[model samples]
Target: MKPFSKLREECGVFGAALRSGEAAGLTYNALLALQHRGQEGAGIAVAREGAVFCRKEVGLVSEVFDGRALESLGRAGLAIGHVRYSTTGQNICENTQPMVIEYLRGRIATAHNGNIVNALELKRKLTEHGCVFVGTGDTEVIATLIAYEALRAAAPSPDPGTAPADPAPSALSAPAAPDSAVEAAVVRAAKQLVGAFSLVVLTPDKVIALRDGTGFRPLCLGRSAEGYAVASESCALDSAGFTFVRDIRPGEMVVITPEGVTSRQVLPAARQGFCVFEYVYFARTDSVLDGQSVYQARYEMGRMLAAEHPANAEVVCGVPDSGLEAAAGYAAESGLPLVSGFVKNRYIGRSFIFPSQAQREAAVRLKLNPLSFNVAGKRVVLVDDSIVRGTTSRKIIASIRAAGAKEVHMRISSPPFRHACHFGTDIDDEKALIANNMTIEEVARHIGADSLGYISPAGLKTACVHGSLPLCMGCFTGEYPLFVGRHTKTQLETR
Candidate 1:
């Protein structure tokens, strides 16, 4: 059976460069904070004394990294970690990230957090050039490309049978240090990429943070008394006691070394395409993305939603978690009382991960139950981040009605998904998306809601106006930032 229907972001990446203390432990804590971005698998790679040790598995961070696992990683001053929900590969152990590649020059570890549109094309070229691969994930392909570039740069030019006379010492410039070569190699590899990616790399001498040219994914630089850190979101930095340094710009490369931090624009940025859904649903409420507060954005979205779609309801209730803040704004704007209408089972993981139809249905039921006291006998404005397939939303509204609610009105904080997302978001088949085929009124009827309203693209822009750049609404509109070509998750996996 197909998995439960919901939009899923690819993954989250965290990297730390500490002057002292265990970087691996800090990475673990940061990964916990980023767990919401991805929950299928977790991994961490630590560098110590010029050696990189990686521990990864197909499970939650807490499940995969026990006391023994952390100890096995040993003490390290530099580390990078990743939590993954596969968009281009299966949710298996081999695809878990922090891909460590050992080359003639040195070793480097990479943790990536987005999909690569041309990964298969790049993989084919690499294979033709005799690059062997282990995992089917795009991250491995990326790491191998970096290693290939670094090695190719470091390798002595193929035997020119007749050697030219050596130039005078003063006439020739010194060869690049291993660290400099690796940084340049990353820039080269990044320039060849054609999709969303915010990745962190642990080199032999430094930690590198690189974001795609379009800034399709969020990545930031942070600092503390000990050293510097880079994370997919600012909230992860906070978990490790790091204060927010400025966000890494689009196509920028920030290298953290023992000497200090240095930055350069590795690739000239294309159009600013930061994902708008980060505010709508993906990021943690506490995270600040590209100078905008996630919580503030969601609150504003809710306020806009209320203004656009006023529900004649007595009480406002948010779908648990992401929807709560928006619900608060809706309640505040509509002058309706905001109450917790559902009791959530905190221990249950995201319902979308359940594989079987029966299991997914059960997960939804076990995950949240309508609180009869608040929702019963009252008109309810039900606020949620989105409705992907309409199945979960239908189930939720049915549960509320079963609890005796007089009327349930549905409100979404973002525009409907009318197109497929070519970036990291797993909005694969347009045919599978409910909004793609059904009109607003049709969707409302299908989902059993008395009324339904979706925040307009304009309203979403207004709410997220604080962002440093323009938003990517390709999933809402057909216009995308880059040439998506014929890329799909299935093609990425099979190729």
Candidate 2:
């Protein structure tokens, strides 16, 4: 809860399948562990006897689901959950996940993390073909696609003489097993999807998960005592009593049923494009993603920052919660004493509550206080993960000066966010990013720091242990790995 700066999580997803009892409780717990990913809304949905039961609202997970509410979901064979910070949609109950629907293949409760670049086009096509739309969010679009595809996959061929008299094909009926039919439908829908996504689907007999071919977001499988669970981060799985299984490969679909786990590769694995922000800010410090330790990556980023941009200071301090590990690494590399600069108020939280620009600007002090004893009269080097608009960083620097620090040099661990993010990390407007407009020198003056330095893209990659994987550095380099829309390409046209 410390380090009350602003970095947002686009969304988080969790699901469990083929368990003995109600899985909503486990889903709820997973959401708690992932609460950092979002705070605007929360929901959980369960599938029981070919029907879906969902309860959701705009609030924190604890505020949305209580013991009584979890009890209401009752015992179910499968369940899926979601916590979201909107990037492509507005905040509304209708937009909250998991989006449940009844199609030809019984019913399903679906949850998703990441934005859909082609959501508008797909929704338009679905509507032209007679699919009635309810919510404006992309999750609903994905649900509808799966429903229609499942219906098509389950539809029996026109055996003119032997065609069934039924008006609609029963999704659970012959040709293939019901579970298999649902999974095929999911694969079909996933193929049509374009952009970042880690989807969790709940059917009557199985729980299914699908990750985008690029793997721009994190998704992993875990083995629980009762069954299998999937989450955007393994820490959540660990919190839910699931042992870490390997991360689900890119473009892979993993199905968990009573028979255990099964998987199929839908897309040819091409280049891997994981979000570097996960290691820097989105994921918990204790979690690991894509074979790299987030804590180690951050620690190394600090060490690398110290090596590349050593600051002349008596002591080094980190912006709590986010920059602590890196500060330690910086201290180790520079051989400077590490100290706590700010004490964060755990009671205050989740920046969205301060809606207005003025309110948000003032919130910095309400959440963090510079410790005079730790920083007084010392030339201190302040290390932070990233500075979005430089608003809070400016305020924090002013506070440190007021608290008696002789000189405050700001050291950032990641490259500047110069472009908008389209695949769901929540910085969609380029103008809102300070780095897009300010030079390194200009930014330092604006933030009231003696000097400022950000980790170079190459340095950041090295710190994260990035090897041959093709990373999504669009926000930094303006070079998108894959193209989705003309507008998206045009925005990153400078590179």
- lDDT agreement with native, every candidate: 0.85, 0.81
- Backbone clash count for every predicted candidate, in the order shown: 0, 1
Candidate 1, clashing residue pairs? none
Q: What range of 10 consecutive residues in model 1 has the weakest lDDT sum?
A: 163-172
In model 2, the runs with Cα more than 4 Å from the true position are 1-5, 156-177, 349-360, 466-469, 488-495
| Residue-level lDDT for 258 in candidate 1 | 51
RMSD of each: 5.2, 5.2
* Clash total of candidate 2: 1
Estimate, for each residue in 384-457, the C-alpha lDDT of model 2 and write its tens digit. Answer: 99998887789999989999999999999998888767787667667778887889999999999999999999
Cα deviation of 465, candidate 1, in Å: 1.1
lDDT of 2 at 340: 90
Give model 2 RMSD, 1 decimal. Answer: 5.2
